[model samples]
Each structure stands twice: as structure tokens, then as C-alpha cells.
Target: MAQIGMEQIGVVERVWRYPIKSVGGESLRQADVDERGLVGDRVYAVRDARGKLGSGKNSRRFTRMDGLLHLSSRLLSDADEPVLLDVDGTAVPDANGFLRSYLNQDDVELAREGEISHFDELPVSVLTTATLDWVRAAVPDVPVDERRFRPNLLVRTPPGCPPFLEDGWPGRAARIGNVRLTFVRSCVRCVMVNADQPTLPHSSDVLRTIAAGHDNCLGTLATVAAPGAITVGDTVALESQDAL
Candidate 1:
């Protein structure tokens, strides 16, 4: 097997957590990492009457529903109450009522994550500037923002590295500040990337380019091997499991 050695790739450029699945995320200056991932990340999801969570795409776990991307969710009142906020930052008093009307479904309601995982895949979604740079180069016309690809931690990889550097990190363990992570696999691209956001517009070219050039995969999904506090400037390092 090829050797995996300790290497400093970059520092955490940004940290994000989605209080609700498939909605606008909350940016963080520092976050407390835990086994489930950054504390309160994807802690809630909108559930349809059929029990599928509302998301940008349909699957056994999620039902593709419009308007979720148009609204954002926030955890307030000590997280006992979660509210859906509009573009004007006004909290829709009745989250479930608003969801029912906005999604055009009678039984849709906002629910917290329970036995079923709210995540599309793994706990922590990780990305790097290298891949974002590659996306820019591949489709210059498309916006190459990290918001286009939601991640818990965005790494600013060292200069002179090629794009898609995280593709090779699976099965390896990484450290960010006091937290340690084990890369599970590369994150597969989906229709969510094409969904519109506050400043980002809907674009199909982004996915097409990834599908054609990078096998429709970007970033990495990781599990917290060791938990602690991590900040924006935390250093990221990759090494073998033994190094943990």
C-alpha cells in the first residue's frame, strides 16, 4: 500500500452548519465538534406525510420538494423552537403551517432528526479551495462559491496543489485543531448543487461539468474521530490511523 504521511494541507477557511436539512446554512467563526458532527448541524428536517424528509432531490430518505431552497431555518429559544425565515429575515410564525402552504402539501411539517439521519450521507461534509478553483476553471461562467457546495469545513489548501485533492483522502484520518476526522468517502454531486440560493442562481452547467470531468463527485464526507472545538483558522492535517 502507498504510505500516508502527516501533511499540512491548509487551515479551515470557513465553517458552516445547517440547522435544518437542505435549507440555508449558518456560518460560524468557531464550532464545537462532536460525534454527530459540528454541534446542531442538520439537527432538524422537514418531513412529508409519507415520512420522507424534504430535500432538493428525491430518494428513499428524501422527497424532492420545491421552495425549501427559497426559505431558511434557524434554531432559536435555546433550540427548543426552530423557525423558518424568509428573504426579509422575518420568521414565519408557524413553521409547519408555512411549510404546508409553501410546499403545497397538507402534511408537511418541520421535524427534528430522530432515529433517521437528516444528512444526505455522512456526518461532516468537507471541501477545499483546490476543488472550488477547479470548478471555476472548468466552468468559468458558473459561480464557484462554496455556498454552491455546502460543507461543514472549507479548507484553504496550499498553493501549487492540483484540483480535487480531497478525492485521495478516503480511508485516511485528518486533524483540524483539537478535532480528528476519518474521511469516509468522496461526496457525490446531486441536484442540490443546482438549486438557487440568496445570491447563487440555479445553473445546470455546474453539475454537467462535474459529471463530465470529475465523475460527479466533489469534497469528502468524514466522521469525527476525536471531538473538540475548531475555529476558522484551525490547521488541517492528514495522516494514517496509527498517527491518531
Candidate 2:
């Protein structure tokens, strides 16, 4: 067995899923993990009338993704209903309806083509509390929260480590019970980080600091090595691999 860190850490918090593409996201207490990613992560995405993939990268010219939010998930409540939330609160009918109201009909087309109903960029995204505190100390002016990074898993780890040190965590696999995740690449920050949580106005310079100090505040992207249910307070184990 490869030697791992001495301290143990558990998932403290989680947040923000892009149900569609550039709209908005919702916070979750717990979620399911599969090969594609967290179930219902980027399940639905919006596209223009011309069938082009509407994303913050290009469509920022015509539509402001920061102004809207899109979220979805397969995990349901005790009542067996979809857990949905809009910019307003935890009660939106569907992703399309949310976009229809948030963005005028002229903008939202037919749910975008080539978008998978269960597609997500990564299996899971994690941010360490230590990294958040470091950023807070480094940039006291900016408000750092789950909304800024939109991570699926927020772990409370030791302090003073380099931002997104998880990128270097290879051979080492993080386990939450039967579920295991392999650390992938460092997430690249973008304008989406500047968008406010709710109707709040966007804050400037936050992404700039992230880009300058940290590697765009993306922390790290992870792939599911083992699929299983994850909940808060579950013991997280880090097993080092020989790769490094």
C-alpha cells in the first residue's frame, strides 16, 4: 500500500450543476455518481435556432450566461420527485421552462443537438477548504463560495498546500465508501465564475485573481474510478499509487 497523507478529510459541502449548458445551476446535499458523471449533471443543454452549441465561450456576445442559471439531477427527494432549483429558489418546473423565462424565446432553441441527456464534463469536481481559505487570505475582497467554482465535492483538507494540489494526486485515489475518484486535470477558470449566485450582480476581478494566483480557480477535475452513492460525513480515504 502506498503511504498517504496522515490526516483524514470528508466531504463538507457540494454545489452547482449545469443542467443545461450556460444557464445556471442548483446546490445539492448529496448526489449519485456514474461513468458519465454525477447523475443528471449536464443532462439538458440549450441551443440556438441554428443548432449551434450555446455556451458562455461564444454566445456571451448575444446571451449573458451569467444572467441565468441551469441545474438538474437524477437524485430525487423523499417524495421521489426531481430536485430542481432556479435562480429564484428550489422550485422550477424544468430546465427548458427555466431558460424560457430567464432568456427570451428568441434565444432558447430546441434543447441543443449533440447534447447528451446524461452528459457531464467530469465524473466529479472537488475543492478543498484549505484552498478556499488560502484564496480568501490572498484576496480578501472577493467573495469565495460554492457558486464561484461550482464543485460537486468540497473537502476540508489541511491548509497551506498549493492551490489544486489534487492535480498532482495521481496513483492516489480518493474513496468515499465504495466510490473512488481519480484526480484528473486542473480546471481552467472562466467568466462563469464571476456570475452571482442568485439575482445578485456579477463581481469583477475575482477570476483575474484566480487566474493570476491560482490556476484559474478550477481546483481539480476528477474521474470516477468506482461508482457508488456518496453522502456527507462519509469517511474519505486516499490511496497512493506508484505513478506519483
User: Which candidate has the top score in lDDT?
Assistant: 1
Q: Tens digit of lDDT per residue, candidate 2, span 11-39?
A: 45554455555545656666677876766
In candidate 1, what are the lDDT values of residues 93-163, reduced to their tens digit?
88888788877899888787888788878999999998999998988877769988899999998898888
- In each prediction, how many residue pairs overlap at the backbone (N, C-alpha, C within less than 3 A)? 0, 5
Window of ten residues with lowest summed lDDT in model 1: 73-82
Candidates' TM-scores?
A: 0.93, 0.76
Clashing residue pairs for model 2: 20-44, 23-69, 24-69, 24-70, 171-241
- State model 1's lDDT: 0.85
